[model samples]
Target: MTQPSGDPAATGVPTCYRHPDRETWIRCQRCDRPICPDCMRDAAVGFHCPQCVQEANRSSRQNRAVYGGERSADPRLTSYVLIAINALVWLGVLATGWKNSDLIARLALVPKGTCESLSSDGYYPTALGERLCTLGTQGDGHWVPGVADGAVWQLITSQFLHVEVWHIAGNMLALWMLGPQLENVLGRTRFLALYLLSGLAGSVAVLWLSGAGQLTLGASGAIYGLFGAYAVIAHKVRADLRSIATLVAVNLFITFAVPNISWQGHLGGIAGGALVAAVLAYAPRARRTQVQALGLGGFLLVLVALVALRVAALS
Candidate 1:
């Protein structure tokens, strides 16, 4: 009796072990192992071995779980929301029909003495008043009374304000790309804390470096804070460092190349965020909870000290 031509035992045809009746012509792209139609899976326009396919599926599922299985948790979404908010605020200013709008100055943080007159009468001036005071004039190196009178609050608020749409858009884009992943790893609370502290550090740097002249606004400081956090976290998790370095270099280039960019704020935020992250990452793992509490407490104390010093300076 003559054997079949395509039979494995006859002409060396590779038979599908599972489906003995079939001959396999394709190989798994990943494992490079032979597989029949039933065993092969389509993976990005190519076939995959059963074991490789299973492993890839498992990885994908794990990633999905980490991302909360929702598309909105995408880092880009956070960035978009921030940009939208800033744009809306700008539009609101335009809609209010105010001429010579001082919207940015009013909401932005300034140095001491730059707006001292506005701080008179025991009441910090209105946002509009602050804007009016800083108009047609620049500030100097130290925190000005009226300019950054309530700078403690400005630390957080300043992250949302911007002098230009492009400025806000750029910062938001960076934030959107970097924030979610950091948030995912650090969890929302820690991430938020890092952002706030980083912004504060940036504001403080501005106060120390510029003194009172230039009016600073925008989220770059806080976004840079995220960059700082990213570096620390990447190291802790053994993630690729090259990517983080690339991001830092690109942003630094932008800061230097672009006119009117706040290099102080960027540096301050990066430093602060990295400091905090280092404390968080390097502290003994067994005492992580205690260490985190202590770190947070220290931050709060520093914040309070800054506020008290500003008030004392005014008096």
Candidate 2:
């Protein structure tokens, strides 16, 4: 009998279906329901009611990009910032620490902790006058003394520190080349985690496998992590991974071929990076955050256990 109020039969002006108290001629472009200004939301082409917006989103297939992030986001921003920090660190090294052994000793990763015997030797100090290098020791030994000597923080700090001009340049160049693509695919936050965690895992490998008193520092471990990330992500999407694989192979060859490079660090980093990429690329979308947290936490615990076990064995 009533052609519905919205048909303009009952009243001259259409009434809002949601807010019956408010009268308006506006109708949702999708559902054709009368909506008030309070219920209006901007849509791409025209206004939509809240219900229509939600329903549209629900019905949407949520077409995911191969890399797992929203297609709309830009991953380059974080990569650029990360590259800048690394470059700044290198600049600081050049300004005050290019030849400063003390600064290098203070920051570089040293496996040995402070002890009466000085444990082992064959390590060279980046700084000559530092107490860590000059301190009296038993047998053939070199000691690097610092307030933070043998501290756990060295694992993190050591990644950003480099010994020579070509060293930082080489590492930073690789970072610049590989960083943006992976960052875009993984998103900024996950990419940062992969880089740091991969580097840490590399350091942990050094701690586990390197001889005592070896001083190892570089961003190579982290860069290697990125390499692993790209490879793993590609594999997940069923995309070609051979290009990254070849790069990894060449780098690994160089790692072992070079005298000072740490193959232990490289191998550790690759393994860590691959595992982390698995966590990021393969996680279920519904529980991605929770799954990532659990995976990372588990790996961290493994590192702590390895460190404690190694320390206890030596002590």
Candidate 3:
């Protein structure tokens, strides 16, 4: 059958499908439908209709970061969230009697459980056995469980716990500075993984190196891990290293020279961060994401193994 023909004057040579009342000779490059200027969207080859353009955009692969993670739209958002969490926890500690807070007893990383005097906020000597301390309840002291005694949450909680104003302030400042940078590079998920794992590494160090009764708490380990990750990323991209090297040196000096600083945590964090960053930076492009995931899993297993060994020894 012959196709019906319309008058050219009534509907210019080829009318836009979206605006049949109007006239347009231009056709959509994608769908081959007549389109007016209002409906046309620029494309590599020619114009596309709004619907076709939307469909194409919907089907296109999402942008990815250098190391295969999805690109983050708001890098600073994650950093702000982390800072808020740390600040809020510090406030809780502040409200609960600062250094004497029972919250600290529950959250702070202690390799082995200890007996604490609730009245004086002091720990009883280990020579006084846990059995003896268990009997002396009200006035004497109470048993405070540690990682060995199944307070496993302490490994993570201790990183967020801070008793001193200056301590929290310093760590928050460091986080605000470093967090966004890493997030932008690694994207939110990988960056968060690097951070939490680094903190765990620091806590593990404290568990093994520091005295059993030594109360270790703070984000310094995580902060140190950020520093280590930054250095690794910078080196990978061939950025100047002198500045970061100097900063790390200065921080190391402070870690060792300071009276009450936990050097073990800081060093352990650095090692963990560097290791994670290395995996992120060096993973082969063909299977970048898979390699990164496997490397990180291996690292986590190592940390878990170390913890198991330490717990066995302490037990």
The best candidate in terms of lDDT: 3
Candidate 1 per-residue lDDT over residues 20-40, each given as its tens digit: 777887877776777898898
Could you tally the backbone clashes for each prediction? Answer: 17, 5, 0
Ranking by TM-score: 3, 2, 1
Note the Cα lDDT for every prediction shown: 0.66, 0.75, 0.87
**2 or 3, greater by TM-score:** 3
**TM-scores for every candidate against the unseen true structure:** 0.62, 0.75, 0.83
lDDT of 2: 0.75
Candidate 3 displacement at residue 125 in angstroms: 9.4
Each prediction's Cα RMSD? 9.9, 6.1, 3.9
lDDT of 3 by residue, 1-315 (tens): 966556554534787788876678899997899999999899998899999988987876466677777779998888899889888988887788777777888888988888777566442223244786788854576788889889989999999988888899999998999899899889889999999999999999999999887778998888999999999999999999999899899999999999889999999999999999999989998889899999999999999999999999999
Per-residue C-alpha lDDT of model 2 across residues 28-115, encoded as one tens digit per residue: 9999998999999998877899999898888774633344544326666666677677777667766773655455656777777432
Alpha-carbon runs more than 4 Å astray in model 3: 1-36, 39-62, 119-129, 135-139
Give Cα distance to truth, residue 50, candidate 1, Å.
31
Which residue segments of model 2 deviate by more than 4 Å?
1-51, 54-74, 113-123, 126-150
Candidate 1 residue-wise lDDT at 91? 74
